[model samples]
Target: MFMEEVELFAVSALHNTATSPRLKELKVQQENDEVISRVLQYVRSGWPTYLPSHEILLRPYFECRSRLSTIDDILVLDSRIVIPHAERLAVLDKIHSGHLGITKCRSRAAQSVWWPNMSQQIAEMVKKCESCRKESNVQQPLSFVLSFLVVLGKN
Candidate 1:
């Protein structure tokens, strides 16, 4: 989704807290640093109970933007850390397709990796996308006759 949409959704979420019971329930499903922080804030403000899990907090937030459901559904709270299932699936798909080596996959999955590899992976996926491939051409170099014709005078 576009960054504008994401920002707008986030702002809307913060603005209308009334329709957030589902959101609250979702957030309560996972425990993460952000959830803990919010929970702590609530406690400081005098709430007696601990905050819900990050997943609990995320459900309503994601539901607010349906496009994000695919990504949200795969996320799990593991010892307070959020894991992305899409990235894992992408890596697995790449490996299965013989596009990525196990070592490269592991390296790419590491926290500190930069954008180059990720961009490469995205490019590869785009190239392999059947819908896109069917509609697009893999442009090739013109033959000498075709190339030289442009230099010749028009009839």
Candidate 2:
């Protein structure tokens, strides 16, 4: 009975986007066990199942107890999970591209269960990236002498 309820909920959630009248009616009447049972049986027979929500699957990856620590761990884990040398290279390439923001990279790294050193490693890697250095903003170094001079001039 529990399984049946779960199946019904899953089906209803999956088909929430469906537009057909029959589907709409089924969705409306979805609270009933008989309707759920029929849907479950139909799904079990041969009909295609709806794609599960990406948000549902990805929820755990983003739910970190400590954002900073978890993000670091994820990066290290990512290094291990991305097995193929080529895949690693590809990921590096993406990192090099401006398309992959720092936060996104860190989040992905955290998801991978990478070591604690992952965030530091990523920082070092970014620091050494010539392209980022060239394209990114360079902050002017602050000087006390400049500040003093500006104050004197104002006076």
Candidate 2 ranges with C-alpha deviation above 4 Å: 1-90, 99-101, 138-155
lDDT of 1 by residue, 1-155 (tens): 22223233344444753423433333444234464344334433543333245446633333322222111222222211122222334333543253343344444333221111344554566566675565455566667767688679532
TM-score of each: 0.26, 0.28
Separate clash counts for every candidate: 11, 10
CA lDDT of each prediction against the hidden true structure:
0.37, 0.39
lDDT per residue, candidate 2, 19-127, as tens digits?
A: 3343233333332434233333333353233433643432332332123121111111222321122233344444445534456656655443232245665666676
lDDT of 1: 0.37
